[model samples]
Target chain A: AQSVSQHNHHVILSEAASLELGCNYSYGGTVNLFWYVQYPGQHLQLLLKYFSGDPLVKGIKGFEAEFIKSKFSFNLRKPSVQWSDTAEYFCAVEAAGNKLTFGGGTRVLVKP
Target chain B: DTAVSQTPKYLVTQMGNDKSIKCEQNLGHDTMYWYKQDSKKFLKIMFSYNNKELIINETVPNRFSPKSPDKAHLNLHINSLELGDSAVYFCASSRVTDRFGTEAFFGQGTRLTVV
Candidate 1:
């Protein structure tokens, strides 16, 4: 069974602070990784994804993720976060023809 | 335009009753899925359909069933819902592209409360 782990359950930071959410998977295969964000009272939307090629992938809303295959980790990061970045972030991974397995989400609260 | 949508944004029902969550996608994607988010905010895959065919069925109980009437619609029907079945159910869809960069578009989840 493939599972994802998000180390940070909740993070609070002031505006312009750098953000980094750690994510690790327990799978060793051709895996596809994704990051999804859910704003207050909104549906989950894709932030970024990494299948192959470049390890660092950029997404909407100034979000970026790096897939480190050696470490079995795909961590989300932002150089400067805004108050509007407050939301729940989810890290998901899926194998071929398999369902996407999500990690326990991390709630981020950015104070302005 | 909303690409993916789910009906009954909030469902409050009694135990032993039957309930269904409807999902429709207008993105013309070939794959759709149902996911459950528990109190702890842990997301779990319940079922997945591709091209109107059941593809992935996790270790979900038999009480839960997913039906796909067409390529763009997938509905979940729960029989004899129990108190433990309370959770936010989300529907999502993705294209069949071989690349892994494609992301799944999720619907506004249906929050079901069993009392």
Candidate 2:
């Protein structure tokens, strides 16, 4: 079974600070990666995704993730963050089927 | 308009009770899935149905069953719920196409609290 690991469990940052969340997965075959975010009371929404081709994938809200096959990592990064960026972020990987294995989410708290 | 929706957004029940959460997707996707978000906010896949057929069934207990009457609807029924079953359940749907890799759209989630 494939598994995902998120090194950061919680992150705290001030407004305008750069943010990065580490994500790694264990899968040898071709994989699809995704980053999903959930606000305080909102449903989970897709932040970004990496299917194939370019390793760097840009997503909504100025967020991006780079897929490094050698490292088995797809880390989410943002040049700058706002107070509204505070949310729980999840990293998910799909190997063959439609089933997505998600990592333990990382909670981000941004101070304005 | 909500793409994917789950009924009874919040459910509170007692142990040993039976409960069902309904999920419907207006996106007309071919695959639907049920994921359980635990207290620690770890999302785990429970069941997945593709085109009204059961495709993926994780190590979830037999007490929990997923029924898909059609491609757009997948309902989960839990029998003899326990305290450990208290968690947020999310329903998601995706279109499986060969050309493009699709992403799953998640529902608002049903918060199940068992006493």
Candidate 3:
């Protein structure tokens, strides 16, 4: 079975600090990757996705993810993070039949 | 206007009771899905319907069934709910386009607590 692993379970950072959440998957085929964010008391929303073409994909709120096929990793990054960026981030991989296998999720707390 | 909506944002019930969670999408998407988020915040797919047809059933229990009356509506019915059924159920829809992969839009989850 395919699985996604997010190394960071919880991350705390001050405002304006850089952010990077590591995500690795166990699959060796044409794959689609995504990063979703859930704000406090809100539904999950897509931050970015990578199906094909460029490995580096940019998303809303200055979020970006790079799909490194060789490493089997798609990590989410941001040059600077704000307090509003505090949320739980999930990395998901599209498996056979379009089913998504999500990671354990990483909760980010950005201090103001 | 909300794109995807699920009714009864919070549900509290006793074990062995029957309950249902309603979901509707106004995005006009062909594919809709039901996902459960456990207390640990791990999200897993429970069922998926495309154009009112069952597409993916992730080995879910028979006690839980999904009904899609149309392309825009998918409701989940639980029979004899158990204490282990306590979790947040989310309804989401995605437009399956040839050019791009499916990007799901989620609704405010219905948090169910079975005592």
Candidate 4:
């Protein structure tokens, strides 16, 4: 069984502020990590993913995440966030068998 | 064009009613999945199908059955829906890899409300 834990349940920030969402997973063997964001009324879209090779992965909208294998963490970061960045972010992990287990999610509110 | 789409974006039904949610993906991926998002925004996998074959089925109730007619379509049917079944159901597709899919594409999600 695999599980994902998102440290923050909700986050509030103003425009131009730095944002980081912590995510940790419990799984043995190789794993694939991903970050997905769901805006107000939109579907879940892939923000970034880490399969192999590079530890740092860049995503759309100036977002990025670093997969720290030692820490078992894949944290999402944005150097500076905009009002449009307000949304619910989810961290998912797939250890094997094409099953993706998701975290509780972090709701981010960016004020203009 | 929408890569992944689910029909009945919003479904409001009553207890004891049987309902179904349809999902379709045009990306030609080999695997499709159904996930449920609860009130607390916790997402959990319900089922997964690869090439129209059931690959994974989580420990959900027997009332919930997933049907994959083809590689591109995966449908979920719930019999005798309960209040607990009210949640957003999302469909996703991906190409299966050795460990898993490299990336999964998700649908808009069907907000199911049982009143």
> Chain B TM-score of model 3, please?
0.94
Candidate 3: list runs displaced more than 4 Å.
A1-75, A78-112
- Positional deviation of residue B85's Cα in model 4 after best superposition, in angstroms: 24
Cα interface RMSD of each candidate: 12.1, 12.6, 12.3, 12.8
lDDT for each residue of candidate 4 in A10-107, tens digit (9 for 90 to 100): 78888999999999999867988889886653346678888899999999999999999989999999999998887778898877543566776787
Please state the CAPRI-style docking class of candidate 3: incorrect
Q: What's the alpha carbon RMSD for model 3? A: 14.4
Q: Please tell me what DockQ candidate 2 reaches.
A: 0.04
Q: Each prediction's Cα lDDT score? A: 0.83, 0.84, 0.83, 0.83
Which residue pairs of candidate 2 clash?
A: none
Give per-residue CA lDDT, model 3, range B55-77, as digits (tens).
Answer: 87987899999999999999999
Among all windows of 10 consecutive residues in model 3 chain B, the one with the lowest summed lDDT is B95-104
Q: Please list the residue runs of candidate 1 whose C-alpha ends up more than 4 Å from where it truly belongs after superposition.
A: B1-115
Candidate 4: segments with Cα more than 4 A from true spot = B1-115
lDDT by residue (tens digit), candidate 1, B3-115: 88999888999999999999999999888889897553546678888899998898999999999999899999999999999888889876623322233567767889999
Which residues of candidate 2, in runs, are more than 4 Å off?
A: A1-75, A78-112, B97-99
Tell me what TM-score chain A of model 2 achieves. Answer: 0.98
C-alpha lDDT of residue B61 in model 3: 90
